[model samples]
Target: MPTNQLTAGVCSLLNEPQHTEDLLNSTPIVQILSVKKVHSNPNAPNPVDRYRIIVSDGEHFLQSMLATQLNHFVDEGKIQKNTICRLDKFTCNMVQEKRLLIVLEISVLEQCEEKIGSPAGLQIPPGDAAVTPSTANQTPAAHHTAAATGGATASTSNTTTPAARGQGARSGRGPTTFPIEGLSPYQNNWTIRARVTNKSDIRTWSNQRGEGKLFNVTFMDETGEIRGTAFNLAVDALYDKLEEGKVYYVSKAKVNLAKKQFSNVANEYELGLEKNTEIEECRDSSSFPVVRYNFIDLAKLQEMAKDSICDVIAVVKETGDATEFTSKFGRTSTKRELTVVDRSGYSVRLTLWAKNAEKFTNTDSPVVALKGVKVGDFGGRNLSMSSSSTLEINPDIPECHALRGWFDASGNSENFQSHTNSFSGAGGAATFNRSELMSIEEVKAKDLGTSDKTDFFSTRATVMHLKADNIAYPACPTQGCNKKVFDQHDGWRCEKCDRSFEKPEYRYIISMAVSDHTGQAWFQGFNELGETLFQRPANDLVAIRERDEAKFNKLVEDVNGHQFNFTCRAKQDTYNETTRVRYGVQKILPLDYAEEARHLIELLSSPWAQ
Candidate 1:
């Protein structure tokens, strides 16, 4: 193909449905219409250079990107406005809202001779007439609340009121309410009259491209719902004027493709409140629906993976005192745990964090409707509130009323199935998973022993054998104390509580090999637990072991084949550069056949199982 004589072949490729991969494989020749730098960052760790260019098939203009490695084309002036080039190799991929053509291999077929006819703005292929460009990769929006907007409110006196902003429509000059679904990167002249269903706390972030603070709010109507964020200066401008559950006559909100991970709204696009945005409180909000919630049943929570957001309605079976703790982030946080149960007969712990925890109150068995709670499996399956999540205390919903009635009549203390901790709230008690039971193999599959905090679980296991190599240890006998005392030959020295004792008290430290069908684990049962397992106190065991080695050995053999429910605490420890799960037995109870059968039936009857 000669330079200028390449002809119509350059224009024919625009209509072909073949994309980036096809272009790269075929290496089609094309003409460049316009060139613009879309993104660049000298400070980026890997250094990025991106460009947006409009390529044409002579009839229609299509937007494409130049590969980062091809920056020299623009830097050295090889690619310029009105340049004709062969897209020898390129790739087409969807970057947010736009299908970008990334040119990799190319040759300059012709230099910028003169401006040819400007192809009409990209052709709206049949079904794409209403399609809007993707708003991703645009400048990040700042969503500042009235308080966080800071001095911006006081500095600017040009704010517009709802009536004044809508005056153009009254005059027929038109800034009419724009359909949220009608928004696009192509249009900036839009006015949306919607209700602010929800707004988030202001958050700040700093990055390579820039640094600024932002906040997000969701607006909805009978037609659909959309979320919008205001950044930096814009936050100060629009935040105070907009109120939750209030109607607003909003205009000039920039529309962007909604980031799938961060948004819960079903809309394909979201909006950004900018300086030019006009928002006026509307008088009536009959058009917008109340907050939307598609709650999942509490019984079904076990089926959900961690980090999934869900809503649920349940009765508060129990509540804990609001406690404070210094978080790793160096900030003090409040936490409160609530044991909640639904009609499905399954109960789970719900932990409220920070402000929500501080504000939580349940004097009685109140109905709670939580939205956007995160699924967590700390010690057990639980629901934790997220920063943006919301909860209602005894909401007026039918489910709430039905739960109250059910809980008050029967589901109170003894009837409900508790799938959580052995003791409710902050007892530091051993906990179970959603199934209320776990096999030994699951202990490793769930990565239970690796957490910084000790993990608790209960399993029905048989005691295969006892470790006789090390049985009881001498310890300080002080009441309410369980410290190892020094055997000084003449006298014992107590160091921990700090005191001297004439003689040391022996404490039971039983080691046992226990197993469920899945696997076996070495468990250490200390003092009380050891006493329960062996059916003998520490001093009695010490006397027996000292009295007759053969008698002590028989006691251990007699306990074999006995079964008990073992509550184990697992912690991760690294030794010789390898991490392993170390099990510590906390409590032990005689296995009850009736309780196990009832729990198994409950699991089988769960809605998720169905």
Candidate 2:
């Protein structure tokens, strides 16, 4: 291609505004004159990289951005400075009074030695004077408001009326509403018209600061999404006012840096609602975009890190009855396990808690769309819903319909591979596969606990001896706070809560020496695992020890020689300037001889064994 020909169409879209739509749809070719990397937060764990590129046709160069999704082009040396490329797909947005072309898709045509023609910087008109090729139903004027205004009274030069300055006015026609993507701590005087994508129940917390209640809601617009949280009085005022899937005009809320540890929203900032925050329901919300999901397939869940949040769509293959359990803090909670499968031929367990568990009655293999569910490596790979998670049963979307059709046709007949290798026992109890069983000698030989990361493995061992000294600790009774409380004579005082409780909950911290054929080693277990081993609550055991020391000693003797399958976590721990590997029991399952024999037979019959 000639250099002059490449530069001939430079700034063509700006020069020929009348044919802008036609040119944008044609996938215009351009030359990359220069590329610069944008700086991002250094404190972020995994900050996304952004690139600003100056492109030219021949006579003029314009500023452009490479979308994050297309970062692979630059990373793989496919696209760089002085490279000619075809803009396969892109959108233009008016940001900060300038036109920014965001390239979504591109193909490198040829790599050149130098910049294409002597191209000068292209100038873009402000506000509505410049026409952009964005498909979103947003105008330059509204985008200008989003970028320029910080909540002072609207300028007289704009079309906003004086009555629009206050609350109770409709959006679009009243005050100019800003985009959620444009929200930042620097901009305070802004109103946003967004739909509630997800809402969390009001939850109370107590720390050294004091006790207070808060609720969170995720809001979305055509531009982007942001999370909003209201504390105490604001929670009481706004909790009942906001409904999931409803649109509202919100303003006067403070914006702060996002806490990435808690949220999966992509925005860099979040909203803090106050007592005087204005929130009026918007009746005209048809123009707003619906809740978006970046769904990951079940087969790929294993590649993701544990505790990461993700969205997934799968078929409910099996549902378990809800079971209630009391926490160490004496708070009762309900949870149910579900076996869900997807087209990837992988099955994973999904746990639902509280109201979500109780309300889930779908038993007809309904397709479920889950958003913001947490990934866990529990039985290999599993999912659990959090308070901010969104669950849609049989959603009237194309993805749901397609999954349903696939399941009814051939998906149901396909035998899926489960993440955990388990089978049913005689009484319908779950039996673990013996293939994962590791001998105590093999564990030590592999130096499993030598690294900083914790290692998990299963083993079958007998309880050689049980330590009966200091077996339990008095923990704070507050829900979710199992910290050990100190005795302050009058009552037990919890430093974490800065409060005193009449009676502290006794939680078990069992230490036992276990032996396999290889060797004997000591292991520790907390509350849940200790309860499973003793078959009684730690509090009851404490009472028995105080009332009848003979019976408590007898109980310990009875469980001394019992053998069972134990899943344990091993990590290097340092105590008093000494470091050693410590094994902590995670799960205790009763031994099933019948299941063990079947596993042996299956293993012997395998081709590898032969």
- Per candidate, the number of residue pairs that clash is 14, 4
Give all candidates' CA lDDT scores.
0.64, 0.73
Which stretches in model 1 have alpha-carbon errors above 4 Å?
Answer: 1-188, 204-212, 257-269, 420-512, 516-610
Candidate 1 lDDT, 546-606, residue by residue in tens: 8998998898898888877767788888999998888887656666578879977997899
Clashing pairs in 2: 7-57, 7-58, 150-189, 151-189
| CA lDDT, candidate 2, residue 316 | 97
Candidate 2 has an lDDT of 0.73
Q: How close to the true structure is residue 99 of candidate 1, measured as C-alpha lDDT? A: 34
TM-scores for all candidates: the values are: 0.46, 0.57
